[model samples]
Target: MEHSEHTEPRPPGLIGSVSGLVKTTLRLVMSRVELALAELSEVRDHLVKLAVLFALAILAAWFAIAFGTATLVFLVWETLGWKILLILAAVFAVLAFVLVKSAMKLIRGGFLGMPATLAEIKADRDMLL
Candidate 1:
């Protein structure tokens, strides 16, 4: 009779490998969620700052326009009469239109989306696929 003395370890079964894969996938999902949450917090902070700046800018601009228009009308009243006021109104309306259009363009540019989280998720998806 021949004697055999092999001491090799067996490979993991499908169930064990699948369980490990599930754990790793869950960990990946959790980490991605954390990243997205962190990015959202950053976006919130940025939005707060932008809102404050926008409010202050609007206040200052209104004050400047009010005082400057009063001074301009006062200075030009002798020559142009009430026509200067009409002209200034038209100019202000045009300027307001332009500013609104610019704001809309900026908003449509996706300035607040979580770009890093999206890219990472896409990369992970591509690797999996």
Candidate 2:
């Protein structure tokens, strides 16, 4: 048999490889973006929960403070005379401030830093192929 030197055509060069890599990267990024969006949704939900809880806690605290202050004023007026009402009011005001400040700090440190987004993303990623 006669031998003929022939070479099959090879694939395209660097540009083809780069394009394939880019397409793969884009697919990965799209999947990741979808995951991040899902996470954002969960974060939004948690934010709503936090807002509602914070509002309820603040309202309850305010009611408690108001009732306590009224009781203190009434007691001071009856027992210690009207002069002590002002001192009682001042103490109540300080307590209210402290309570509000501490509550705000706790809310900020706990619910606000809950990382719902990160957790959701991780969970979703784990569920992925």
Candidate 3:
């Protein structure tokens, strides 16, 4: 005759259950932070692009203003002398307009928001609740 011994698995006690929950919570928080960091890097890139574009726009606007003033002076002195300056001023104004429009489009594309991170956080909150 042979005897076999078997033990039933024990359910987690309060401390063990609480420890598991804490670990899970910490993991969730860490993952969310990592996601935010990744998204912030992308945001940094967008910011750099915006900065460069705005700088160019400002430069173009300055050129437009300067040329417009020059054109005004030329118009007062000689009518035909102002034509080239007026054309240059118009070109610079158009360049500034295009740069600002591109910047607006980038902003509209959600370059400033961490969409995925926000969605994940909302999901996590819903799950916990």
Which scores higher on lDDT, 1 or 2?
A: 1
Candidate 1 vs. true structure, TM-score: 0.77
The best-first sequence of candidates by TM-score reads 1, 3, 2
On a 0 to 1 TM-score scale, where does candidate 3 land against the true structure? 0.66
lDDT of 2 by residue, 15-99 (tens): 9889888998688768767866776677688789878987998899889877987777776677778767778768868987997
For each candidate, give its TM-score against the true structure.
0.77, 0.58, 0.66
lDDT, candidate 1, at 82 = 97
Q: Pick the candidate with the highest lDDT.
A: 1
The candidate that achieves the highest TM-score relative to the unseen native structure: 1
Writing each residue's lDDT as its tens digit, candidate 3 over 45-76 gives 98898799878978997797788877666666
Taken over the whole model, the C-alpha lDDT of each candidate is 0.93, 0.75, 0.84
Report the lDDT tens digits of candidate 1 across residue range 39-96: 9999899889879988999999999999999999999999999999999999999999
